[model samples]
Target chain A: MASLIPLTAPDDPRIDAYRVIKERDLVGRGGRFIVEGRTVLDVALSPRNRFTLESLLLAESRIEALAPLLAQAPADLPVYTASQAILDGITGFHIHRGLLGIGLRGAEPSMAELIASLPEEALVVVPLGITNHDNVGGIMRNAAAFGADAALFDFASCDPLYRKAIRVSVGGSLMVPFAREGSAEAILDRLAASGFTLIALSPSGASELSTLARPPRAALLLGAEGPGLAPHILARTLTTRIAMAGNFDSLNVATTSGIALHAMRRTQITPA
Target chain B: MASLIPLTAPDDPRIDAYRVIKERDLVGRGGRFIVEGRTVLDVALSPRNRFTLESLLLAESRIEALAPLLAQAPADLPVYTASQAILDGITGFHIHRGLLGIGLRGAEPSMAELIASLPEEALVVVPLGITNHDNVGGIMRNAAAFGADAALFDFASCDPLYRKAIRVSVGGSLMVPFAREGSAEAILDRLAASGFTLIALSPSGASELSTLARPPRAALLLGAEGPGLAPHILARTLTTRIAMAGNFDSLNVATTSGIALHAMRRTQITPA
Candidate 1:
């Protein structure tokens, strides 16, 4: 069982990490990230996730409700409870969910290491220049849902560990293995050399998605919303189109990921 | 050519509909709605869409660049040009896109009328209790991209015509044909009577999406992010699951729609 530390003042030094959280640049806070709400916190505390808990801040009323989760935390990790007003003051926002956790991001596997670790038959999602945090989160969620081996991001893409992205992903950012390293071209070269069929999604592709034969090992290359896959990247892969109707040319990139992943999942030729 | 009316004041009576647009309940604004950004405005002005333009507001600098689109508008329609500051003052926020339009929402066909108008072989998406305007917009965008015949929303769902939804959809709300009427049960009943196969997407569904045969005419029923389809609704339809690999149960409802619609489209059998 975790020890409960009662916090009466918002300025308490131990709770300083939770202060004005919305304003703080929490993304690369010396490897620290804020996990919000009960649902996401549950995932953060799970033994399977690499995130290390620094402390937990909760509303007094929520402690009893979240006892099971608190019990799961390491005994050394402090669980602090405060009045709703003090909690709100400490966070500089009304945390309606009344739960916030400070977590230390664990070391991520290198791109080469991640690729080397993949199974003989694998499905991977490569997001290129996907700058929107929400789209990043949504893509991570889709990657996990479809059981893709990993999500590889180019340097231009936003950090999946951004708080908003993590929340949008419903803690998927932590659950799904991901790595951001190298330029788009470098990553593509590595993927191709690794015997992965690079399928690039574009409106002007050579074939409809349904007509394409499934590759033994495949990587679906996706781009940001408006710009889509860059020309060089599109030229390097087997281009495929989703066959849209009407004048609208695209679906949200995250949605596109889900559809493409599902289609790829169907065509996956598992080894005998 | 649309006539240019020079507007110098924010309080001009002619621009009343554009005043405090952010605060105004633009949805069902007595058959009036606001259209923002260049892309969406282009759709709103299209002859193919039912929206009738009340007026077009443009930043003085933008008028020259948008000459082609302005020319597409009816000659009698009023086109107002104002300085960026004046346009911002009128809308109670930055009109960064430098384009806004007040459009009169045309009559929406009844659910029965809409179903009757669909092609013999059609794909439709029904969103139940989907109150998020952005989700409604995203779903509409996906519906259009995948060529879903129409989107039917239950009365409890938020209006698709809402301004934010339109922007998020990249003006898809204006392009896609959607209607909000009846309760969940009523809409499902209508769909069944119209020779549509009702397939409710749920996490605990019995059959995987890949195994399901495409019905001649299919309607994919979706629920909101949390508190998914009510148990009774799931029991009433042929339940299907989007085989998830991770511990997560579902994708974002809009993303789910895109994936399901894409699956349905592949199996579509067009009549001779």
Candidate 2:
């Protein structure tokens, strides 16, 4: 079991990483991320995820409830306990959930290295220009929920590891293997070269999603909310649309990812 | 065309409804609600919706840009103009979108009245305990996007007409007809009485979504993120689940609505 280090002073250098968390979230720490809440910490501690927990800071009131979790962590890891006021002082805001952890990103594999390691019948989600952190997180959650082997993001997309994104994803962002590399075209070229069928989601697409047949290996290409997939990207894949009523033509990109991924999963089991 | 009334002071009694909008948004202003931004105001102005506009407030620079919309408004309706600073003072914050409208909810029909009005082959979305305004708004957007005839919300659900919900829905809450009334069981009974097939969405559902055949008249019963549908509600309806991978079982309720609605729409055309 890890040792419980009491933290009475807010300015202690050991807990400096937890200071002004909201501001630090803007200019993210290099190779490190904050995991908040007991539920997310549970995911972070799981051996399946690639994140390594550096330390944990818990509110005194919550330590008793989280004893089992703390007992499982490596003995060398420091577990700190602080009053709610001290915790708030460190985080620069009221953290009602009262559990926080600093985590380091594991070695990130190159896009080629990641893709080559996937199973032969892999399903993946590719996001382009999805700059909203919430959408990126939501997509990761959906990808994990729907059994997508991995997520490939273009450089234009927001970081999936952003604090708010990680929290919103319920830590599914950490569990899902993702790599943000290359331009949209370059990623598309690589996916196509790997014998993956590229399917671009767009409102103007000719084929309805229900009627389109899924390939043995599929990569769903999604874009930002308003502008949707760029014309060049749409041209390079089988363009399919989620049919909508005439009055409203759009769905939030994250929600679109869920529907598209679910549809892809269905097609895999029951061929169209 | 709407007559442009010039407002020189933020404390003007005629514009009292716009004061401290964020706070007023909590209790809400009796039967009235504020609509923000150009996109949402566009939906509020549509003649098909059941909202009646009391007045409009626009930023000075936006007056000329919104001329077409102003021309379509009832001639006697007042369109107020204020400088950005004055608008900010009245709203207790920066009004960056700069367009606002005060709309009165028209007579809300009884649940029976609303359900009875739907077509014989209607598809509906029923949210049981969705207290979050964003989720309610998102569900409304998905309902509108996928052509669900109406939304039926139980008392446990948040007000779909709430300001934040309306904004998050991109005005979808206005375009789609929705009513929050009765308990979950009462609403289910009403729907069943109206010849609608009740299908509850739950993580523990026995049937996969793709395998379930669509009913001619369907009502998708949904719940909040964590608790999902209550046990009794699930027992009363045909429980269905979106087949998820073993690692993660949850999807955001709004995303689930979108996927389920799309699946229902697809099944309507291409029977299982």
Candidate 3:
């Protein structure tokens, strides 16, 4: 079991790494990312989790409820507990979910290396220019739920490790195999080089998802909501649309990904 | 054009109806709900929108950009413009999206009436135990995107008109037809009465979505993410699951609804 350390002050210098989260988010997580809520923490500690949990800071009230999860942590891990008031002061937010931890990102391969490593009959979700944390997290969750082998993010997408994204993903960011970094073209090049059939999702794609042919390797590429896929990107890939009703704008990009990913799995995984 | 009324104070009694939003929410909505952002406002003013745009409170700078939408509102509708600071004060939050409106929900049919009125080829989304506004909004947004005839919500579901729900929905709550009321059994009873084939989605459902046969009228039923549908509830409906990999709990209920709705469309609407 991790060691418990009582904390009376929110300003204790021992927790400086927690404060370094967003800066590391911009510069690269210094190998550290924040996870919030017991639901995510549960995943971060599971055997399948790709990352390592380094430490935890919890509100005094949450300790009992989170005991089973904490009991599974590394014996040497430091568990800091503070009053709810101090916990709020430490996070600088009244909206804290009372459970927070820092996960150490493992040594990761580049987007190119990851794509080249996909197994045959692979299903992959590729997101480009997705800057919304919630959407990024949702896509990650969908990717994991649908059994996609991997999720690749283009340079413009938000970090899935951002606390909000991790929380939204229900720890999917930690559970799924993911690699980020590369321009859209760079990522697309790798996918194509690996003989992956790319399906670019758009509100105005030439064909609907039902018509997409089964490929040995299928990669569904989704872009940000309003801009959707770049025209050139669509031109090079088989562009598919999720049919919708009326003249309203398209579905949320994350929701679109879930639908498309599920469709891909039907052909790739469950070939009924 | 709706006349723009300059507002100098946050406490002005003229916006009392906006103040009554949540209180009205728990009750019958007093026939009034709130919409936020220009995107939703555009839909509220569109010809197909069911609600009446009674008033708008905007950040002073937003008026210029929103003029096109405001021009379409009823000429007598009150358009209040306030500085961002006063707008924040009025909303009691720093996160104000700078656009708020009061929408008058027209006299609506009950859940039974709404379901009973569906066309022969109809699609409906039914959410049970869905209390999160974001999920509620996302479900409604998916409902609109898939061209479902209407969304029917059980009593345990949250209001789709909550300001946050509306914003997350991208105006879908306003664009889509919806009815909320009734217990789980009552709602299910009405769906059966309407001759709707209710497909209750569960992670462990007996059949996969890819194999679901098309019904003349299909209602995709989703439950809260963690608890999902009650066991008794599952026994009554055709239980269907989305194919998945190693168990990751499940996809967000709204995402499940989207994928299911899209799958239904392929069979019900497109008939491919």
Per-prediction DockQ scores?
Answer: 0.76, 0.81, 0.71
Q: How far out, in Å, is residue A111 in model 3?
A: 2.1
lDDT for each of the candidates? 0.84, 0.85, 0.81
On DockQ, the leading prediction is: 2
The alpha-carbon deviation from the true structure for residue B37 of candidate 3, after best TM-score superposition, in angstroms, is 1.6
Residue-level lDDT of model 3, residues A3-101, one tens digit each, is 789998878998887655545543336677888777888887778688888789888888898899898888888999989878767766643567778
Least accurate 10 contiguous residues by lDDT in model 2 chain B: B20-29
Query: TM-scores of the models, in the given order?
Result: 0.94, 0.94, 0.89
Candidate 3 residue-wise lDDT, B115-225, digit = tens: 777887788888888999989999988888878889888878888887778888888888778888988889888888877887888878889888888788777888888
C-alpha lDDT (0 to 100) for residue B44 of candidate 2: 74
In candidate 2, what are the lDDT values of residues A87-126, reduced to their tens digit?
Answer: 8778888764778888887688888888888887888999
Least accurate 10 contiguous residues by lDDT in model 1 chain A: A20-29
The Cα error of candidate 2 at residue A127, in Å, is 1.4
Model 3 spans with C-alpha error above 4 angstroms:
A1-15, A19-28, A81-97, A268-272, B1-28, B75-98, B268-272
**TM-score attained by model 2:** 0.94
- For candidate 3, the chain B TM-score comes to 0.90
After superposition of all CA atoms, the RMSD between model 1 and the true structure is 2.3
lDDT for position A66 in model 3: 83
